[model samples]
Each structure stands twice: as structure tokens, then as C-alpha cells.
Target chain A: MTIAYAYGPNPWPQSFWDARAAANFVCGGAGAGLVVAAALSGARGTALVVPLLAGLAIVACGLAAVFAEIGRPLRAANVVRNPATSWMTREAIVAPLLFACGVAGAFGSLAFVATAAALALAFVYCQGRMVHAARGIPAWRAPQVPWLFVATGMAEGLGLWLALAAFLELRSARVAGWLGVAIIARYVIFRIYRRGLGRALAAAPARALDAAGRALLWGGTLAPLVLLAIAAAVRTQPWAPWLLLAAGLCAALFGAWLKATLVLRAGHTQGYTLPALPVRGTRA
Target chain B: MTRWAMVADLRRCVGCQTCTAACRHANATPPGVQWRRVLDVEVGEFPDVKRVFLPVGCQHCDEPPCLDVCPTTATRKRDDGIVTVDYDLCLGCGYCAVACPYQARHRTPRAVFAYGGAPAKHEAKRHDPARIAVATKCTFCVERIDSGTAQGLTPGVDPEATPACVNSCLSGALAFGDLDDPGSNVSQLLRENRHFRMHAELGTGPGFYYLWDKALPEAAQ
Candidate 1:
């Protein structure tokens, strides 16, 4: 019988999902995060306007980036036709609903804001599933991927909210505390996800992924936590707002970098395999 | 109720790659795009090495991961079990490309010719413009099979209806027929030989079977 063997080091080309696709992940995570933060804060006036406009803009930009990656952009509308099976179709359906609800929420509809927040979470989840559905890629197919994305998206979104709050001089100890919790949750999930990857992946790719995971842990998760603690300690100081802003900025940038590395660099296809090979010292 | 299938007899195959050339010639596929390929795998250490030629393309699974992951509903499986892509409906997002464990799907962003500069007349005429930027893979020569069936011909029995690879296999290693029919050549081959479908544990239920000359130890006893 025919046997399968691992094809080579890298079976598929890296160009399949390029930088544009990575940008989509970053933008999607940030956009969903901002919407969730806005819903949580229930801010008014300039506070509301900043998140509403910025969130929608980032999400729209992410969609545009994905559009740029398609070979036939005109046929992209067909993506909504297979919601029964495709996560991409589900994402397409939820994204517009999130936008509409976010806009309505900004106009003072608390019901719409709540709906937008829920839809934003769903959109983020669908993004994770979109990656997870690639059964050929071991890293993306891990069960922990979606959870990691959800946690990271919320953390990044909350960090953006804090940055906006600092810029607008709005005081919300509750929001800052929630941001801290989200960052901590993200760190825990990131560790578990990396451990899962280490077990699932081959030696070479696993080492490479471990390197990227370490960077994400130090820069994306821990560094922001440190900055947030510093800001908390110096709350009475005049430069407290600046320190909070810096923490938020660092968190957001690191989240983006993490997603970019996961989607673009760490993404690899499952190679070919041959099942039937004679064991050493055994003759056929 | 015709469930199309293929059986490759590994014992008879000479690893000549004639099937590969025949498939390329029949399909007029662009350079670097091999709808069918014979992979030469060298197993064991250098002193006791054995070279085995494995022909792989699409397994044409019963539950195709590619079809399940296609966002555009472009990849479809016919009643006869051939998986195909509707180029018009495909967005070329490469989702199906990655979902395919078989590594069967391919997308060429730009057109290229075997020659450096220009495509030959026959090559230009045979090339499908719709498949340029979209995903494409082996169709099991559906057009020829369908046309032959309409003309009261059996695909496996008729050279005109059979796939290029099967038709051109000089060693009679490749056979194509309806697996549903007990009397079909593929079914008979499966019944008579020790055969296995690749990645069957993945629950793909692949239609392509590989037949080995040696029987299992238990079966031989």
C-alpha cells in the first residue's frame, strides 16, 4: 500500500497569507476591543465619540486589508453564502451588525451598545475560528487559539479605552481595574496556548514559535502589567495620565505584533506524510 | 449511484512518471502546476535504501475538508465523487488551500508559460481563463467521463473516457471505475488485493486506494 511521509521542512509557501492578512488580525482585534470597552464604560460626549469613530475606522480598515488580499475582490460578496459551515461567512455577517450597533450605541442607545458589544465579541470569536478552521495548520487548529484571541482582543481593546481616557482626562478606576484583569487573563491564556503549541508542533517550528511566544509574553503581556502598576502607584502625581497612556499604547502595539507574528510568520501548512515505513532492523 | 474511485497498484508501478507527463499534456496545465505528480520517496538508510514512487494529487475524500472550509461554496463534490472548484464563485482567499491536507489545491496569481516569454497556440487555447486567479485541482477528467457516459460508454473500459493518467499507465498500475458497483474493476481489485486508503484515520474516506502485492501476515497464514 502507498505510504505517506512528511514532505519537507515547509510544505506550503509562506506567501498564501501575507502581511495584509496579519493586518486584518491586528485591526479586527483592536476594533472589537474598542467596541467592547466603549460598551463597558458607557462614556458620554468626547469619550463616546473617540471610541466610536476609532473602533469603526479600525474595523473598516481591517476589512479593507482583507479585501486587498483576495484574488477576486468582486467575488468577495459571495463569502456570506456559506454561514452554515464557514466561519468566514459568520464573521462577514456579524461585522456589519457590530458596526451598526456600535454607531447606534454612540447615539445613546444603551440597548444598541449592549448588542454591539456582544456582536463585537462574536466577531472576534469568528476571527479565531477562521484561523482554527485551517485544519492543515497545527498552530491555528489548537483549541486554545480562539480563547487566546478573545482574551487578547479584550485586553487590547481595554488598553485602547484607557489610552483614550487618559487623552480625554476622564477618570474611571473601575475601567482601569477591568483592564488590569483582562491583561492578566490574556497572559495566562497566552502561556497555556504556547504550551499547547509546543506539544502539537514539530521540533523546528516549535522552537521558532517558542521564541515568538517569549517576545509576546515579555513585551505584550508583562511589560504592560508593569506599566499599569507604575501608573497606579503614581495616581496622585501629575504625570500619572501620561504613564497610563504609555501602558495602554504598549499593550495595544504588542497585541498587534503578536497577532501579526501568529498569522503571517508562524503560519505553516501541514506537510505530506507516509504512514507505512519499515522499522529499523526490520526487513520487508 | 456511481461512486467513482481509483486504485493504484504499487507492485506494478515502475516510477517512470509517464502518468504525470500524460496528465500534464492532457490538461495543458501551466508550468509549476501539477494536477498529478509522482513523488519519489527514498526510505530507510543509504545502505539499505528502497526508493518508492508515490503518485499523489487529490484523494477526492468523501468528507473533503477543502469543501467544508470554502467560504464561497465554490468547492463542490458531484454524485460520482469528484471534487471541483467553481472558479467564478471562488474568492481565491486561499482558505481551502490551507484546509486541504492533501496539498492538492493551488492558485497561480499570474499566468506563466513553459517557455520564457510567450504561450504557444495550443497552450493558450487549452488554458481556462476562469482558473487564472482562483483555486484549481484535479477533476478526474470529469468532462471526458461525462461525455463518454452520455455516449453509452464505460469510463474505466474506454480509453476515450478514462483519466489521462489511468489511460497512459504503461504498467497497468492505475485503474479507475465505480466503487459502488461490485462488478467494477476497482472493486474487484480492492477485493483481491491488500489495499489501504491514505489518511483513512482522518475520516476522509478517500476514494483513491493503494494496492500492495504482499498480503498481510495474518491474512497470508
Candidate 2:
């Protein structure tokens, strides 16, 4: 018998959704973030095309991974039937819109870029709410979860944009400044999510979230900030772009790691809790 | 409007698990799946410890979170408040499973028998093709309720109309009836007993009520 069926009253990690679900959050966040950041950065011509295609491809990979996770893949169309109440359905609707705009923006015009970015942001928002809709899992059901996802996605996307900027030799201090802001914002949201949980989560989930927060603080937040700072200081140097690229990679990869931990390791289901225990034969 | 509900009296329970066995037999659920089960919870520390046999399953809440989060519209609630799953439409995405706080949802991707290999005669006969790769849960014996009620039988009072678990309960601890009916057996039980729903603060408005005489004196006290 499983621990759940046997012991029955303790929080345990949910097996229904595994690492496959996390792939959607990680890749989808980074991809959507890249689209939004690229549009906001004002990349024109080939500069815009490269990042847009890359972002769409990444998002497509996430969609494919989730498709593999569903038991009835043929009945996938049924997911779009309830957009009125289901965030997953809303996400399904937004993905195609994002793709259409992304494809058009790659070769069409700057207007398409803005449109794709809006759709991409909506897609990430839907994904965040999708995770939040898992009311059984305390760690995922935080009201701030959607905001956390948005901030982290923007931070990761900005990191990817900066890394690609290094490759494409595109420089914009204003966008880089936003990246720093996003990273710190993500850290702040993570802290709030943890504090809000406050004994509501099981021991295992609480520890897992704390460990992820620690990693986000040191590697994802602090390290990236220091690198971006140094890159700004050495703006005149020929190798400053490399410093920015390294910072971008740190931010994006660490964000991916934290989300993976959130979905897989910290996804413990709420166990049974009786407010007042009843003693047999007690009188009213 | 008739609303189906259940009440479990803590004073009368014996932790025999007869209800669990009966439910599994009636449903012919795959191995490792129990539609209704009792949780043996040992609370408090050392000197004043007490073990409570907590019966749990799908609460079939009035505000079921599972119904709202279903991406495929596979999970539904009847006008009577009994939540159900449409096996044909479900993609088994598990969103409803996670949304359900009761941990009541079950999904079987492939056919598996009680024994190691091959299907027994009874297993093959009971195997539902549509159940494969779909989300499932306790339906509160909807088939019995519908068929029995068609003949003008009232649920909770008639054995044929009641849920299999409530019928098989060894100690008469489990009761099921229309919560909307003030004169119902479950309603009388609720009126006299001090009871509470599990996780009521979550705002699910669960129909499953646990009745106790009074709060047990804490061991620390």
C-alpha cells in the first residue's frame, strides 16, 4: 500500500504531476519572457527575428512536453472547452495567439512584435494562474504565485535577451536596468510567498521551498546582480558584453532550477486535518 | 432541491473497514484503489494518546474546487450536489485531482489486476474500457440512487437506494440522505451532535460532516 493509503494523514509529494509539468513552467516562462523583453527592448529587423523565433521554439518545446504528460493526448482539444473557468484552457487559447503574432513579427513589422509580447505575457499569466489553481497543494495555491511566476519569467527572459544581446552585439542599458529590477522583484515575491505560507505547508514542502529561495537568493539573484554591476562599471571594455552574457545565463538557469523544485519537489498535497479531535464515549 | 450528503458519527465507529471493502466490491475498482476508506489517526502524545478512525472519501462539496479547475469539463456536479466525472471526456490532465483537497480522485492509465499477471474472470467482467486513462472518484452510488429513486424509493432509508459504503458500515456510524430535507435521518443526527466539516476554512462547503460529542480534553491540559 502507498504511504497515502496506509498511514493516511501526512502530507506527501503528489505523483500525479511529475517533472513533465515543471518543464512547461520553466521553458514556457523563459520563452514568454524573451518575447516580452525583446519587444520592450525595441529590436528591429534581423535582431528581432532571431530572438522571436528562438522564444517561439522554446515555448513550443514546453507545449510538446505537456502534451506528452496528458493521458489522453487525442482528447487534447477538450482542454479548450472551458476557458470561462479553466486557466489551462485560457493558456491553450493564448499560446496560438502568441505563436501567430510571433511568426508575423519575425518577418513582418515592429507592430507584430508588440502584439506577440502582449500575447506572450498573457500566456505566462495564464500559466501562473494554472499552477495557482491547484488548491490542494499549499505551495502552489499562494495568491502571490501568479505574481511570482510573472516576475521570475520576466527576470529569466531578460537574462536570455541579455545573453542573445551579447551574441547579436545589441546594447541597451535601459533594458539591462529592467533585468536587475525583475531579478530583485522575483526574490522579493519568493520571500513573500514563503512568509505567507507560514506553517500552512507541510514540513517537506516548506523545506523544499526554503532551499529553492536560498538558491534563488545566492545564485539567481545576488550573483547575477554583481555581474550586471561589474558589466556596467566596465562599459568601455571590449569584454563587458561577455560579463553581461554570463550574468544573463546565471539568472535564466537559476530561475529554471527554482521553478523545477517548486513543481516537483515542493508539490505536496494537503493531508487531512481535524480541528478538534473527538474522544469516543464523550458527552455533548 | 434535494442535496445528497453524509454524516459520520465518531462515537459509533469501530474502525472495522467493512465500508471500504463493500465500496471496492461494488465499484470493482482496480487494485490499490479504495473509493471509501477509514483513516486511523493516532493523535496527542504519550500518556493521553487517542486513535480516531476517520472515514474519508470524496466530500462531494457544494463548492467543489475539482469542478471549477477541470480543464476538459470532465468533472461535474449534479443538481443534488453529488460530484461526478465523465470518463469519456477526461484527458487525465490531473488538474482536478490536484484541485480536490480530499485527495479523492484516482486515475488508472492501464489495466491491472489484483494478482501479478493476467486478468481474473471477475476482473475482466468488471473492467470498464472508458475508465482507462481518465480521472475517477466516488460517485455516491449514483446508479443505485437513480434506479431506486425511479421506483419511488427514498435514499438513506432504503438499502437499494443508499450508497454501498453507508449500507455496509458495521457500526451504523455512516448516514446518507438529502441535506435539504429537515426530517431526514442525517439532518436529525446533525441537529443533536456538535459536528464540523474537514477543512471548512478552505470554503469548499463540504457535504461530509463529522459528528463528535464534544472537544476532547487536550493531553497538555
C-alpha lDDT score of every prediction, in listed order = 0.80, 0.89
Model 2: per-residue lDDT, tens digit, A1-284?
Answer: 13133338887788778777899999899999999888988878777888888899889999999898888999999999888899999999999999999999888777888999999999999999999999989899999999989988999999999999998999758678989999999999999889999999888888888888898999999999999999999988999999899889999999999999999999988999978677567543
- Model 1, A32-130: lDDT tens digits are 988888878878777876887688788899999999988898898999989899998999999989888888878766688788889999999999988
- TM-scores, all models, native as reference: 0.92, 0.96
lDDT at A62, model 2: 91
Give the proportion of true interface contacts each model preserves, from 0 to 1.
0.53, 0.78
Best-performing candidate as measured by DockQ: 2
Candidate 1, overall lDDT? 0.80
Which pairs of residues collide in model 1? A3-A274, A4-A273, A4-A274, A4-A275, A5-A273, A5-A274
DockQ of the two-chain complex in candidate 1: 0.43
